[model samples]
Target: MPNSSEHPCRITIGDDGPLLVEGPVEVTCADGTVAVSDRFVVALCMCRRSRMYPWCDTSHRRRTQPGEKSRRDTG
Candidate 1:
């Protein structure tokens, strides 16, 4: 459901990361599934490694330098 808005939604792209989308987004997956979020902003997973699927669980941050901590799943 969508209502008339004065401002259009905004979407941002990074060189290497998930997509940054404006608040309260609804995304339709390839399987005809719908993913929804109510946060002020949402990071849509670009990498298919997210455990949360369309939502980003920071699983894309597997590349860490030496001595740096990795955000990849450890559990």
Candidate 2:
């Protein structure tokens, strides 16, 4: 069987931020490792630049391109 199972999960997408997921959520790695998060909310990394994989650590706020703007600037 798979290490993890699907269930009803709430998700919120931002125009220029992490994907917010309502937790307690469990995540399993491809190598058979598992990580559990019990926070009321968990932010999933979208820009793939987070040092914390599968989680948001505010890395997305950093400048990525010469003219890139943050959500604060656009919104």
Candidate 3:
């Protein structure tokens, strides 16, 4: 998790894929590591294909086409 001073950000799960995280957040990994960024807004990788894990690499787009199998159990 990011520092509380960062003010945090809002993450919205798109209907397709790719979580949209908007600014002021300090996104952290499973190990409690935080991402270094000078900016506020950032798009995180939810599909787990990003060379920059936790950041969007557009892999989700490939997994979610018009008629592809949905791997995520949103429920």
| Lowest lDDT block of 10, candidate 2 | 1-10
| Model 3 misplaced regions, further than 4 Å | 1-9, 38-40, 63-75
Q: Write the per-residue lDDT of candidate 1 for residues 1-75, one digit (tens) a residue.
A: 233476667779998779998878879999999988888789998998999989888888657677677665365
Model 2: how far residue 43 lies from native, Å: 0.2
Model 1, 58: alpha-carbon shift in Å? 1.2
Instruction: Evaluate model 1: give its TM-score.
Output: 0.71
What total of clashing residue pairs does each candidate reach? 0, 0, 4
Best by TM-score: 1
Model 2 lDDT, residue 12, Cα: 93
TM-score against native, each model:
0.71, 0.63, 0.56
lDDT of 3: 0.69
- Candidate 3 lDDT, 12-72, residue by residue in tens: 8877667776664567799998985545567778778788877776776644665667866
Error of 3 at 62 (Å): 1.6
Rank by lDDT, highest first: 1, 2, 3
Model 3 poorest ten-residue lDDT run: 1-10
